[model samples]
Target: MPGSGRLVDVVDTTTRDGNQSLWGATGLTANEILAIAPTMEQVGFHALDFTSSTHMSVSVRFHREDPWELIRLMRAAMPRTLLNFITTGMRFIAWQPCDEEVMRLAFRCVVRNGIRRFQFAEPANDPSALRRVARMAREEGVEEIVVGLTYSISPVHTHAYYAERVAALADCPDIDRFYLKDPGGLLTTDAVRELGPHFAATGRTVELHSHCTIGLAPLAYMEGLKVGFDVLHTAVGPAGNGTSQPTAESTLRNLAAEGYEHDLDPEALGRVSTYFRELVREKRLPPGEPREYDAAYYHHQLPGGMVTTTQRMLEEIRRPELFDAVLAEVVRVRAEMGYPILVTPVSQLVAYQATRNVIDSERWLNVSDETVRYFLGHYGDFAAPPDPDVADRVLSLPKVGKLREAEPIGLEGVRARFGRRISDEELLLRLTMPEEQVDAMRAEPAIAERSVPVDAGDRAPLVRLLREIERRRQISYLRVQKGDDLVVWRRAS
Candidate 1:
């Protein structure tokens, strides 16, 4: 095989990150994911990120599937590869913090369920909080710890700020790698040109984890590779491109051109893509595709996952036309209320506040409880403080006083509320949510029916092409170009 001497490991995030983009976070059922696990394993990816505490809650809340079972199934199918989880350090996936004992028990449950890798991220860039949990992840037998330096654009999030944080992680013995995570897909090539080399200079293995929201992730990946990133996180074709990472096929070609070697079997990866293409067509699910760059995204900075969700919320109120207005409001809301890094809970909170500002006749008249809690410093620290006038208004709200008086529940409180004899998994779930919701999850069915039947026309060509390719073991590479579209596949010799 012709290759670049330097090896680059490909970590696929289709099942995990792709779900966040395409399915509003809980779209794929446990059975659907399990069916594709073996093929993903065959693709020879360095690692596969399967779930997070957020996705686990999504599983039980929306899919009625046991998250523990999902982890076990994925681990069983991909025994040779590391199974990964995403976490917000000690918070354990809830919007608020949890007791240390609760976090410790959750780590044990994940490790016992066969998750070998943990991707710890703290949006606030607080290393002390992460250290408390990273040690626990290691103590519980996790083999790999990838800390995410979440990417965002703000006054406090300059290139120097990120470089300092990455360097700080070097002292943590449990951190094996650092991930430059662009959850909003906001990283541009110019920024990557400067930031990439500085990250390489950290003298630690760095992985570029970005999204395709504004379509610059591919360009960013190329720049990162040229500057010496050790790994690139991407997703398979039918599950990639638009809101997810760039397609593996295109990335492989670009990396090969740059003299990098990847162990991924492209032909096997194509088969995996083929399965999803057919599955989406049959289920009438949306197929992920590359999107043109949108400059407006720079101001809104809503991730691909949040874009779809905010769109749905707009439609629900019959004010879909106001979607752009909400995006515009998000820019203002983020500025007035401290410039927090836009990821997960923060991103969701910003959007919620913006939605109220756009819909209500009076500005700030209908703030969400979460937004009030944010002003109360419940969601960790922010890079900047809220505007003076905005701070006074938020502080004066009656809800702020009520929230301050409310005591947070610790491990003993959780046991008192849910009982001590309950298994750790059940206790952890209840601790993050109400007991009624967990009970409903236990009573509901495992899976839901597909939204629509598969179309024969949509599935035939790809299905036939894959079967033919499977019959030709002697072929090492396949390239097909039609119009401006190009596809490439490589098989193990």
Candidate 2:
């Protein structure tokens, strides 16, 4: 109400975070993304949260598609929109920390491909680490560097704590702006009112990227617009509500209702949404739906994806009943480990340890290698001091000594191992992923030219059948005939 006639910027997260949230990061292929890219460009989005190292790894490991090709194709298809790449600051596809040269090269390769905007978050929220990463991306010629002020609910993460972190980066010339990244969707209306001014004080453009895991992000986003945030991260259609960012269509409408204007074409947005909706239906993928408020989510703070992953892991071990126990242990494990913000790597580490505690008879009896490295300072300084007893127990383990003494391989070393003949894009993939996975990706055939069926009418079922038959190597050909209609597809040798 106070900011009537103000214009807001919208960043589309459908391809990246939304895909990860609703479809487990493997939903859209290069063909699917390319099919809808032209229409997405018609909608005036500030940027497309396009890809990340994790998503790239997902492409090779799951779809056997070259991620570089996806970027190049998408860039060509949507030249007007900025493609964004988000990172964890310290690592690439692998969770382990990499040498500075490796990270620098990774950023260079990313910018070289098509990513113009870079957003990074340091799990520990270390200002120095964030500043260094920002400079690295800048040096690599990234157009915009957005540092993330990762949000969490903990005694140590107060408004003053965040303000101090923001102030620490106030003089960072390499950083173009700051984003309040709430991966857990834990931010509330009250929290926004309290924290907005501190972020605004930085005198830099600030954006808000929050998830709707517990049904609070949309409301928080509305309140955030009233605060200092000007740009909001949203997903398109099937990718937007439950675990992902707020939907772009609803966000734009709400913005208008609240006297703010966004420069997105509703018709274009509708087309993009319809494409994804049909894709979801055809693929039988789960669509993001509105979630009821879950008050208990605040205590554990596991992001939506992690929760689903943990459940699957439990089910895999035939211990689905241990879900509640693992979650409860997550709360305990997080506190003992100094309440690191439940984001990537950290969140994963906490969840892993919690699962182990639930499965084993004793807590901390068996620690993961990553957990050992985390406590050994390989992941940067802890946000807060860990429980003294727990730290002693973790540090005393034999694995900690080896993890502390080991050094991550440098870029040249990686090149030597993988051979310098391969392209930087492939080399980066090999450096972070398993050799067999990369090899399989290389051996796989080119993704088919078939597009997702949007308006196929009765032909949709036939398209689905063809895709299924294509997956089976033993099936050489498929022929379908109904009434006077007949179609035959033969697999290429």
Candidate 3:
């Protein structure tokens, strides 16, 4: 079969995996999560793959969670579309005993509330326990249960061990498919070409979850499709974490060009991806790109510190000093952490990079050492600085600068009050400075280069303008046409 003919299901991970941990950033709001759902469905993806219950609830503001609860909100929001969610009792780091009963209840609640597709993984490497969880899910009428094998950050096991787990799935009636979920994006392509077909032929159906952690997921996904794989997961926006998900739209675009037919259309899917990318830039999110821009992506991260938490450890060297040594350390830290040095969450990436870059360069090593210690002490506490606001903007945005968290508020409500006439990026900056100061910043109009500080006046408007430019670029994806005023999703022309 040509590549397109073989591609079938596309599972989206924007909400679950994308939001909870953004690249070089932190978790997204429930509304932020909800905001993307309809677009995801619009992309013709087979499922939404909502995030783990453990990840989502903790990240959401507590109060705004009631009506239109994220899950319920998304379900209701995309009523006609097919979507599924996965909740894990399994901790990625190591196996810990969790109340299987609690896990079951969470599953039941999510399923009853609208989540149809569910995944069950072992807390540790206990494949045996997962079978039991699968059995429970089967009892609950979940037709498709995904069991994870070789997920990143899970107990690292050999291919042989993974084969053994694949064998173990035969015991669970609920398990319709098994996944090789490399969340840390650690899978090697050679392993994929060899193992992907191997798993597909294992007399068991399989799903493949790969990432661009070391930068090979897109090719790996292609290899999976070529080698006989089924559903593959991806994110529609640049807001996705670790490795980007392979979108149905992009893959379908390739398929259409190659004369392949799919259950869904590429043009329709493109419309959604466009909407999603807009959300990223509109919110000052790190932009997602194809292979060429990976290094630039890290260099261009919004808040710089999140990208350089390790570099901060290196002795600050003048330009003449060779950066080879510093770069080497970054690679080492990345390998040790099993993830990239730069992950992108919406607000956090810019804030982190901004903080890191502007931080006194003279104190780089001192800060690096402290950040390294913190990273080591708290490996996955990626969401450490929940929110931080500048001193002057505190009262106006009670929810802005929280280092931890506050009762969650409605992102929809906030946007509604502010007027969507301003983009997410503009809203963030608008909250940061006074109107008069904003105009002054817009007036002087020095571009944001190398993180220089502006007088409150120049600073506010400049921030607004930068974000406005970004939002404009993302919106350009839906280019206007001759007859129609708006660019929209339509059947292939």
Candidate 4:
């Protein structure tokens, strides 16, 4: 097992994928990432799945941190390894069809800032749309384009179905490799053994990206490796098990026992894991514990990040008990809606409609605007045509007809929507999010990079906590009060 020369590449998705699972969707601020990035750079992984347009929006909208700043910092920290970003076809971060200019500029911005590779996928599996985006991205200096075969179980998504699509993807000129993305961790070991080889047969480098949601990802990964995948996605300690990808430490151990060699340094990766494990403990964040195999996950096919978000949405409506029912409805609705692979946009659309159906007792009564657009073919053609009755019901809504008549925004339209005063990159950000939010982001100064203390809770020093306030002195008086404590301070002009 010392050096069999069957080398594998380990792509880490901790900052992006793990943050989505453990921390909320936009968790893991830039400061937190910078603290551990240098260590991860030394771990010898192939690349880091770092950030995305969704991540950028989340950073500015919720965390008030600059997303570009994150890229710049991470690029400087990990100058040796490649950075991977996720994108949907012709869209930056939103669900609707985005302007062509916005998409082009965003692609260039991502690459210019340091993302050397991109993982592109859309739920509808529109090869032409993917090729279009890839062509533009290639022109804009993106080094590697990784198109994904998003995995799910459905009559329309059989092995034959994927083999044909994989063949088509192989012909895609801009695609450097392919990824079999099982975001839901829904693939069985046997299924992977059958499906994995198809991707490799494409004559392009292929990788397996899956979640540990159903506890079958590791097994599925082994099967994929047996079939000759060139790379596997994994994460470090707190970011790895549970609903996230399998831990790199465990995967390396598995490979060593199987008589294979990988480029990664187990000792360096272990230190990275140690850092995150401590971070999880100090922050009271959930650890990526191995989950028991749950048969229900096959039906829901909800990714790790979505599981928490869906739960929160249910809790907000005071219908937490209906969570299981909602999941079931998702399966039924997905089948009715043509079995689109349950990844983002489609996954979110189906989940929303399912929750509505479960709560309202009247299916499709209050359909979301996005669902109507999906039914009308604004996103793209589905794998299978939608159930006729469901389609009729969706279109019967007052706004669906008008939405269908709308056209995709072009470069000129984008320029008209936002003035030419700002740089193309800034305009792209403004177009991706609400103008008011972008304004707020621009108004806020960049946060100085610093180490994030996980357990600052009540033990944090008052002076250190209120350092921002201390900088403002206009003959000010300050007082703080907690449950059973009070402190006061005054200063003369």
lDDT of 1 by residue, 95-177 (tens): 77666777778889999988999998786877777777788888888899888888888887899998887777768887788
Whole-model Cα lDDT per candidate?
A: 0.80, 0.87, 0.48, 0.81
Q: Which scores better on lDDT, 2 or 4?
A: 2
Cα-based lDDT at residue 436, candidate 2: 96
Candidate rank order under lDDT? 2, 4, 1, 3
Q: How many backbone clashes does candidate 3 have?
A: 29
- Candidate 2 structure lDDT: 0.87
Whole-model lDDT, model 1 = 0.80
Q: Which candidate number has the best TM-score?
A: 2
Off by over 4 Å in 4: 1-5, 413-417, 449-493
Considering summed lDDT, which 10 consecutive residues are worst modelled in model 3? 89-98
Model 3, span 6-101: residue lDDT tens:
546777776655543353223445555554455455556667766554443333222223211456666876775545655444221111222444
Candidate 4 TM-score over all chains jointly: 0.89
Model 2 agreement with the true structure over 1-493: per-residue lDDT tens digits: 7559888999999999998877778788777777778889999899999998889999999888888878887888889899999998878989888899888988988888888999988898899999889988888899989999899989999878988998899889998889999988999999998888778888998999999988889889889878899899999988999989999988988887898977899988888887788778878888999998998788999986687778878888999999999999999999999889988878989999999998998999999888988888788878789999998999999778788897875676666788879998898888889999999988976554444523322235666688778778999977888999999899998
Candidate 3 lDDT for residue 141: 63
Candidates arranged by TM-score, highest first: 2, 4, 1, 3
All candidates: CA RMSD (Å): 9.2, 2.8, 14.5, 5.3
Better of 1 and 2 by lDDT: 2
Q: Work out the TM-score per prediction.
A: 0.88, 0.93, 0.57, 0.89
